[model samples]
Target: MRTTKTLAPLALAPILALALAACQDRTDDAEDPQSASTSEADAAEEDEEEPAPVSILRPDIEPPELPDLPEVPLEPLDLTIGFPEGGMELDEEAKATLEQVLESEQVATGAPIVLRSHTDSEGSDTGNMRASEKRGELVKAWLVENGIAADRIRVIPFGEQNPVAPNALPDGSPNEAGRARNRRVEVAVVPVPEETVPDDPADASAEDAD
Candidate 1:
């Protein structure tokens, strides 16, 4: 019995030592400093990587304003004119009227004045047309000599075909009085709108603001 008890204790000694070694390895693994430090550093890095909040304050700005403009005055115009008797000639009265027309108002740039001449039905159509054309040319020449630019005048001839008189006379022949009236030249002045002057620029701006 004593020998059996001593052998039994010797066999159990190896098993006890193996169990204690397993317990010591588990304790060392639970308390590892390198693994614990890595976890703490990862948590700190995640907290530091968060983004900052945005601001909402904005500055004030103003819009641009438009400038004002002023009104302009209108000018008066005349139309009536006269010529000499018995022929398509510019008498004293006619010349005076023309001079007034040229000086009283601003002769707009690029405006054309049409000068039309007519003749009586007393002559052939061809002859009357030629005579009327000559009269128109003569009038154009006169205007050029009187300081008006030649380019501003347009001459046209309308003979017996276009008369301001009646075709029949008192005795049924062409009326001499009517024919005489037709044997005249007419000058029609056309004013150019673009060449007209406007109000002063400074004055215009003031009016616009008001």
Candidate 2:
């Protein structure tokens, strides 16, 4: 009976040793930051996969070539140009109008262009006069550059002397449209003398045929 009691104590000692070792392993796993972080990284990596590359199929036939567009020719323009307030630049519409004037047949005949430039009542008399003259010179320069004879262009600068439109409203407030209208350059073609018929026989025969 004494021998059996001693064997029972040895058996209990091994069982207690195994229980302690299991508890120690569980504590180490809980305290390990690297193990916890590794688990989190693995979970994140499993959430998504890389996208596949896209493939496009090319067309079997070639495309046709586009035809060039025909350009419309410019005509004559006896324009009244409205300038931006105090600006020397001619806007798109004004430039297009000038193109028409340049493309006219009469312009090629060296017909004189009378340029009447005026300014809005917005500055001192002398300043307005100078600015208006400069504007006139700019227009003349453009015309001369585009093949119009320089001597044929007559520049007349009227610095706020003749207001085509009222510079201000009845309440003394500035009228923008009026001011814009006042700042203008009027263009007109000078007339040439009509020559007498020299009695051409060919022209007379052609007229008789008509």
Candidate 3:
């Protein structure tokens, strides 16, 4: 038992230490489950999905053409009624026209109408003026009898003036058509004022937001 033994463990000690360090690094990685799971999840996400396709827009779109709107007539303000010489009464035709306007909501709006009377220059200026005034007075009286207020009907007497047609022709001959046109009264109707309506609160709020 006195034979000498060889020391080979010093040379193997470095290799054993390196192997033990490598095993310790693997043991630490295994202990951290979150890191292994995160790596696996990232790799799986890259392998399982792809980007979707996108659409390109064109600049050639256009809106549809609109239809034409309907045409409407304008409201008439005056009504011309014919009269006989020195007449103060309204004819049936004039009465009917007046009644129509009175019932058409124009008088209901509380606005006034004008009675412009005329004559045919057949009498003295003073007499014609008096006759014209009488004509307007008669018309006003008729309207008052038919439920219209006297204050709302103004009288304007244009005696033998503002004739629509010539009283005489170029050769100085009497023109009946001109005289007939001159004997008239124009009733000027006042339009009713439009009533203002309130907007809905919700709609107003929406408009305000915009």
In lDDT terms, which candidate is top? 2
Question: Whose lDDT is higher: candidate 1's or candidate 3's?
Answer: 3
CA RMSD, predictions in order: 19.0, 16.6, 18.7
The residue-level lDDT of candidate 1 at 99 comes to: 73
- Candidate 3 runs further than 4 Å off: 1-76, 192-210
lDDT of 1 by residue, 131-176 (tens): 8888788777877887889988887888777777775677888676
Give the alpha carbon lDDT tens digit for every residue of 106-144 in model 3: 567677789999888677989988888888888888889
Looking at candidate 3, the ten consecutive residues that score lowest on lDDT are 1-10
User: What's model 2's lDDT at 26?
Assistant: 93
lDDT per residue for candidate 2 within 44-129, as digits (tens), equals 78775656676565487566788988644324336776685558988887788788778776576566898889999998999888
Q: Please give the distance, in angstroms, between residue 53's alpha carbon in candidate 2 and its true position after superposition.
A: 98
Error of 1 at 86 (Å): 3.7
Segments in model 2 whose C-alpha atoms lie over 4 Å from true places: 1-77, 197-210
What's the lDDT for candidate 2? 0.81
